[model samples]
Target: MRASVTITGSLEDAFNEWTEGTARRLTDVTEQAASTMRDELRAAMSTAGLGKLGRALGHAGYPGGGNYSIHPAAEVFVRGRAASAAKWEGVIDAFNDGATIRSKRGWLAIPTKNCPKGSRGRFLTPDQVAERFGPLRSIAAGKSVLLFADVIAGKSGGVRKATAGRIAQGRESKLTLMFVLVKDATIRKRLDLDAVIRQWETRFPAMIADVLKDG
Candidate 1:
């Protein structure tokens, strides 16, 4: 969002000084606008049910987690300063604008309903899954379908661990499906960061006027 300050009568002198980049109060106005932008961004994230991710804006210690800085030019954005910055940056971008996430590796293992979450309420990783439940064998369930992988159909056999329990009696528990390996996954756009920016853009002129008026 860009703040265009138009000076008419009483503020013409201040605007002229601002054009030459000599107006000291213009810095104050920029700071106020940037602060409002940061707050609105956090509010927007919270409204989109991304409170945890938004909290990272305040956590400068995190990889790519720095908020806003006061400068003559108003700016609010995430800066990648760490090794894992790209990973964390994608988190914000995915939520801001809808994204299609493809695996960097051969396949991306997505957790199924049968998959268990970790202690931190996050889905278990592939290594964690392997640790908890022995190992998971790979079976190309023909074409692109995870649902068919569990049920017997063609040359592709279902992934199952046969237990000692008698299946002849027909009271044995069904096998568990841990994950669905896919090439890519789609994430719908949920955050309106642009909307917040637009809102601040309109209010920026007034903010500048107040600062110049006070001076």
Candidate 2:
């Protein structure tokens, strides 16, 4: 359930060694485990005469992260298990009665027909996001480029304000370029997201390396 790693070396040397060795090994192991689980799910699906359903089941299975969703078929299968049948039946009943599933990552809320219109299905490729926002170029310069951004719906307004205040009060370096994305109620607010990203691209033209997206 838990793993701990320890390295005996100078701090810098230990960090560098760990980054190259254990960190890379952990990443590889995690990926392999996920792939194996996918294969197992695929095999299970094939045996059930539901290859498409199997593929979907594989996609829904969480391999590394502590989050997963039971596909409709998987839910049925779990409910059919002789030992856990009653418990699973209760779960199925709750799900049918509109109960939200909870996972380690976050609460799972089922959207209803009356749910407010929002950017649910929209996505931006890394390149498109970068092109719109420009490269976060300044992040590479000076003693350190202190990066700050508002996580969507993050409850840390005071933290953000204090961070900005610290920079203003000369407690933090002026070389730090701040990036703030305001989430607005409407789709039009995302137009602002594009502009804020572009400003970063324009301001720190020299430091642009790569842009990443939350998968």
Candidate 3:
């Protein structure tokens, strides 16, 4: 985001002072661009109004593990607060939407009831379904899972002898929950999965190094 500060002094004086100070402070920093822009904006702010302000611009990278860039700009006399608020809101919305997919090593496994005793077919509760499938609970959280009952389907193919016992007892058979083993963490992230796997490679570099060393 960019912001400008007004200066009663000449534009050249303001620009020179601001640029030198900013360059000295942020030449090699990770946020060099943003820092420089902020300094320039502060210089402009020292001036009374937007009329004496020069241009200031900044680029803030994504706060989350996603790839996003925030560019903000404002002239003098304009309140920077509104623009800053809007930029922050945009970032929050992006995070809420789960724009980036993260990866993990293992999968979330859930077990469901294929059939209950005394029922001709198998049946599974929504909770059981969620336990087997990772996304069911996430999608169902803060709302009624019963509302999604229509979408749940069931099928039968292989049955264990013990499971068959329950089926013969009149358990209802139905598609309880869809089981999906996702190898990529990105899929869950897209589904708005709560957990964010960040810095996994860094955290597990020893294991990765071993694999690489062997390979």
Q: Evaluated with TM-score, which candidate comes out highest?
A: 1
Model 3 clash count equals 24
Deviating ranges (above 4 Å) for candidate 1? 1-32, 59-75, 79-81, 138-142, 145-174
The digit string of per-residue lDDT tens for model 3 on 1-215 reads 99998768698987676655443333223244334444544444344243222233334422323322222222222224788756544433343354533236454332234322224444544444444432342234232122121121234654322245456776554433333333332211121212222332243344334433543
- In order of appearance, the predictions have TM-scores of 0.61, 0.24, 0.18
Per-residue error at 197 for model 1, in Å?
A: 1.2
Superior by lDDT: candidate 1 or candidate 2: 1
TM-score of 2: 0.24
TM-score of 1: 0.61
Worst 10 residues of 2 by lDDT: 184-193
**Where in model 3 is the C-alpha error above 4 Å?**
1-98, 106-165, 185-215
lDDT comparing candidate 2 with the true structure: 0.35
Better of 1 and 3 by lDDT: 1
Tens-digit lDDT track of model 1 for 1-215: 99998867768876665654534556655665676677778888888888767755531211112332223465665545675566667899898899998888867788886666778989887677666555555657754434212221112542333334433445344446677788888999999888877887679888777765765
lDDT of 2 by residue, 66-152 (tens): 422211111113323465665644443443233434445332222222122225643433233334333433233342232322212
